[model samples]
Structure formats: structure tokens, C-alpha cells
Target: MVIVGILSIGFVVLAILLVLVRFVFDLRLTAIQQEADHSQLFRRKINHLRKIEQARHIRYLLIICLMIGIGLAILIGSFLVLMDKQQKLTAQNQIDHERIIYLEKQQKQLMANIPLKKYPEEGIGLEEYEWEKWSEEKKDVNLQRQIESAISKRSAQYFDSFDTKVSLSTPKTISLQLKGYTDDDASREMIKSNLDAFAKEAEKVSQLNNIHVRMITSVSKEKQVVYSVNYSRKKSEDKFNKQNVSEQNLKNSGEKG
Candidate 1:
């Protein structure tokens, strides 16, 4: 750019000098021609006038060519500058596109790892995650049918102690609870064994569903148990009851106000 500017200045300076020289030369030649004509030297005056006109024309042509060259140089410089800027913009756009793709992929991985139960909101960012969970649930609908089929196939083996319940918390581990009624050690052992078999079947189904399975054996009071059962169900119910009462009181207070 600096070189182009310098060359442009030089061309302008040169053109100015050529014009000034031509003007001065034409002035001097016309003055000499007039002096010769006044002295009655017609032939010399005519020759001087003709030479001056020819030289003036040649200088005009040179100035026009120099102006054209300067214009072309400026045009070329402007084109180069525009092309450079365009290339930079294109490269930046490509970089931005790749960055966006990387961020989207990372977001997908994060959402996939987040449990549905832990999801905070139903917004654009979570839409794909919600859809995926919904699709998984749809596919898992056949799990019940598959379990029923397996139970029917083994109806004879568990006819005496076949009562069972399944609990599924979304995006969490799946649990299968088997009930035992008898107090006898043999009966408890048989229930445990049956629960294990059912657990294996549940595991197979879980594999298909891409979920974890937990087998839990629950016995009635008549059955002697080694481990104490947690009363969390009663605790949760109490908590819920208290929460509801508080909410009702607040609503009544607001109405009164």
C-alpha cells in the first residue's frame, strides 16, 4: 500500500512537471515567433509556431497516458484489498461454523448423561433430551408384555409364590419386589431363588431397555427376616400430608387477605 501511494504521488508530480514544462516551452516559442513576425521573418515565425503545436500535442498525449496508468494502479490496489478482506471473512465464517458444531455435540453429550428425573425445565435445550426419554419409554412399553410372557412360560415353577410387583422411577434403577408369605426357612429360600431367577429375566429385559435392574425380596410378617425394613414409605406420606396442610393454610390466608 505504501509503495502504491508513493508511486501514485510520483506519477502525479511527474505529470505536473510535464504540463509546466510544456506551458513554459509553448510560451517561450510563441514569444519568439511574435518577435520574428514583427521583424518581418515570416518563414521562421511559421516554423516555430508549427513545432510548438506538435510538441504541445505530444505532451498532452503523454499526460493522458500517465493519468490512465495511475487510475489503473489505484484500481488494482483497491481490488487486492477487497479480495483480502473477503478471504479473511470466509475463513472466520468457517471457524465459527465448526465451533458451533462442536458446542452442539458437547451439549448433546451433557443432556444424554443428565437423568430425566433431574431435568430442571421443559425448554429448547432440554427438548431433545425429553424426546429421547419419551422414545425410550415407548420402546420399554413392551417390557411388561415380555415379562408376562416369561411368567406364563414358568407358571408351574412359581405357582405357589408368584406374587410380585415392579417399581420403575424414570431415569433411575428399576426394582422388582417379590413377596413371600410362609415362615418356614425352606419357603424363604425358595422365594429368594425364585426372585433371583426373576431378577435374571429382568436383567435381560433391562439390557434391551438400556436400564439397570434391582431385585428386592419382600416377605410378609409370617416370614422371619434377617434385615429390618425401612419405613420410608410412611415417612414420605407424612411429609406429603404436612406439605399439603401448609399449602391449604397459605391458600386460606391469602383468600382471607
Candidate 2:
């Protein structure tokens, strides 16, 4: 497009130059004829006028051609731009369609695992895990007890107003999500306090456990609010060793497998 535009401008400039040159030549011819005899000068002047008229006609044609070239160039450039945008839109649509299909397949798989095959409108739906199927040799009873104790202590403060949900990820990691709260200093303080309690409990449960937690609070102008807390736990090698020892002791005691 840029190159075409440049060429168009060059042609227009050339046409203008041609017109100027023609005008100068006619003026010079007239000046020369003015020094001659009247009759001869008149004949030469008439011929020069004819030549000037022809040049004027040629200049007009050049101007018209230049205008047409510029118009065509602009039209072609606009078409190319439109075509590029269309191609991008088409590619984006395809990507979105593929994403939707993938999510649909996942949804179907989840539905098939449930006996009822029912879908909920909100919240995550998960397939329950059977603890009995897990290897007893790898079980960490002491760590489990510690986590339960922490949850119990934290829940005692706001169990009536808030529901508690706990999820365990790995041997060391735990994630917590809290919902429903008015956006106020009190709610914020409660969240902070609960988080601090959880952190403290996690620290006491195993010396080598580190906790990472986040809280999200949403409040509306009408005083309605919702909040959630998410936490993860990571256990160090020392804690893992201690857990293994505890498991061995449990196995040696001949406890329930």
C-alpha cells in the first residue's frame, strides 16, 4: 500500500512538472516573436497558442489519470486490511470452538462417573476418594490428627456463621475455601484470625510443614458479601521421615489395616 501511494504521488508531481514546463516554453516563444515584424509575429503567436492549448489538454488528461490511480490504490489497500481482519476473526472463532468442545468432553466424563449423572449449576463437582483403598503403609496418622485438630480449633470461633470446608491435596498440602461474609472490618478480622490460627496449627502439626494461604473477600454496596480462603501445605523431608516412622509404629502395633 505504501509503495503504491508513493508511486501515485510521483506521477501527480510529474504531471504538474510537465504542465509548468509547457507554460514556460509558450511564454518564451511569445517573447521571442514579440521582437519580430507584426504579421510574422502574429502567425507565430497563433501557432504557439495552438501548441499551448494542446499542452493544456494533455495536462488535464494527466491530472485525471493521477486521480484515478490514487483512488484505485486506496480501494485495494482497504480491501487487504479487511481481508486480514476477517482471517483473524475466523482463527479466533475456531480456537473458541475447540475450547468449548474440550470442556464439554470433561463435563461428560464427570457426569458419567456419578450414579445419578446429574449436573449442578454452580460449584465444583468432584468424585469422592476412598481412603480404604489407599495403602496403609504410606498413611500418616499423626499428621492427619494434627490437621483435624487445627480445623476443629479454627472452626470453633465462627462455625455458627460460617461453614467450613477442608480439602487435602498431597501429604503436606491443604487447600481451604471460605464463603459468605459481609464486607466489613469485622469480617476481614475474622478471616485474618482464622488464617493465623490455621497457620499456627499447621506449624505445630509437623515442624517441617510450611503453609501458603490466600483469602478473597467480595462486598457489595448493598452490604452483601462473600469471601473465601484458600490454603496449601508443603512438608519438608524431615516431616516426611517422621510420618513414615509413625506409620511403621502403627503397623507394628497391629492396628486396623
Candidate 3:
């Protein structure tokens, strides 16, 4: 549009200049034709001079018009380039904003958890030592009591939430709702195996039964189950499964299996 507008304006200006040149030439020609003796000779010179002036004027106008068109094209192209850059930058800005929010949520969740007390991982059995710490934390944290007191209490305040439960039961079958971060077995098994191991050790734990372990995450306020497995007290073939905000069931607070 800009290019067309500029070219159109150049054409109009050229037409006006041509008309003015014609009018001047006509007046000069009339004067030259009036003389008697040298009328013919003067008329020829006037015609030649008019042609030269016309050529010079048209050339100047064409050059000016071409320069204007080129200027308009450059200006419009530069504006489009700026607009394209702005759009890409806006999209990148949005992605950065989302990433920041995700990191902040992770930080908050970490801050809410219990601080770690490092123990030897090589020689010492984890269950023998960790149970003392677990017992203290399980009793100390106000939220765990609420969950332990009643199995049905599904949610709790942030930081007040720890994702583990140990029970004394001798039932034919047991259901385990495992909490995990990823879909991989190493990641998912952290909670499931951790619970199963603890359950085996805990007083009157199931020995001969079908234990169903489910790996799930939180979606909105509800639990989203991602993986599931059914096995017996004796080792059995493993089978599959899931981001949750408020984590469920951890023996140690502030840490993930």
C-alpha cells in the first residue's frame, strides 16, 4: 500500500510538471512565430531548446520519484521486521514466565518439608536407624497425626504434609497408594517398595496376601493414578503406571523417595 501510494503521487507530480513545460513552450513558440525576417530560424531554435528543457525536467522528476519509492519500501520493510521481532520476544517471555512459576512452586514445596539428618548408607541398615527418626517426626508433625488418626483425611496444610503411613494390619489383601515424581520404575518404586518393605517389617504386616500398589499424582485437588501393580508377599513379576503439589506419604519429611 505504501509503495503504491508513493508511486501514484510521483505520477501526479510528473504530469503537472509536463503540463507546465508544455504551456511555457507554447508561449515561447507563439512569440518566435510573430517576427517577420528571422521567424523561421528563431522558431527552429525555440523548438530545439524546448526539447532539451523537457528532457532535463522529466529526468529530474523520474529520479526524484524513484528515490521516494525506494525510501518508502525501506521504511515499510524495517517496520515489518520490528513487528516480527516483537512477536517472537513476546512468545519467549511467556515461556519464561511459566518456567519461573514452576520453579517457585518446587521451591515452596521443598521449604515446607522436614530437614534431613544424614545417616550412613553403606554398612548400616536404613530401616533399623530411620525408624526412630520416623517415629519422632510422625508424632511431631501436627498434620501426620490428623492423617494417621483417620485414614480418610485426604488433604492437609502445606509443610504440614508428609507422604508416608505405617499400619498394623493382618488382612487378606492390602491396597497401597504410592506417591511418585516420574513414570520410571526406579522413581515410582521408591514409594511403593519403600512402603512394602516397611509394611513387611511393621508389627503384624501382611505375609500371604495380594498387595496392590498404585502410583499416582495430584490433578487439581484429586489424586491422578498413573501406574498400578498387584503382587503377593513372595516376590512376583512387576507390572505398571504419574506432578502433584501436596505430596502424600513419606517416612522422612521434606524428602522424596
Error of 1 at 22 (Å): 1.6
Q: What does the lDDT read for residue 67 in candidate 3?
A: 64
> TM-score for every candidate vs. truth?
0.33, 0.33, 0.29
Per-residue CA lDDT of candidate 2, range 100-218, in tens? 97875565445334232112222121112233322144666665555544554344334212334454544445545443333356545654554554444444334324343333333
Worst 10 residues of 3 by lDDT: 152-161
Off by over 4 Å in 1: 31-38, 42-53, 63-67, 101-257
Name the lDDT of candidate 3: 0.46
| Deviating ranges (above 4 Å) for candidate 3 | 1-44, 114-257
Q: How should the candidates be ordered by TM-score, best one leading?
A: 1, 2, 3
lDDT by candidate, in order shown = 0.44, 0.49, 0.46
Q: Where's the lowest-lDDT run of ten residues in candidate 2?
A: 241-250
lDDT (Cα, tens digit) per residue for candidate 1, span 37-59 = 35556766667777768777786
| lDDT winner | 2
Question: Candidate 2 clashing pairs?
Answer: 174-233, 178-229
User: Candidate 3: how many backbone clashes?
Assistant: 8
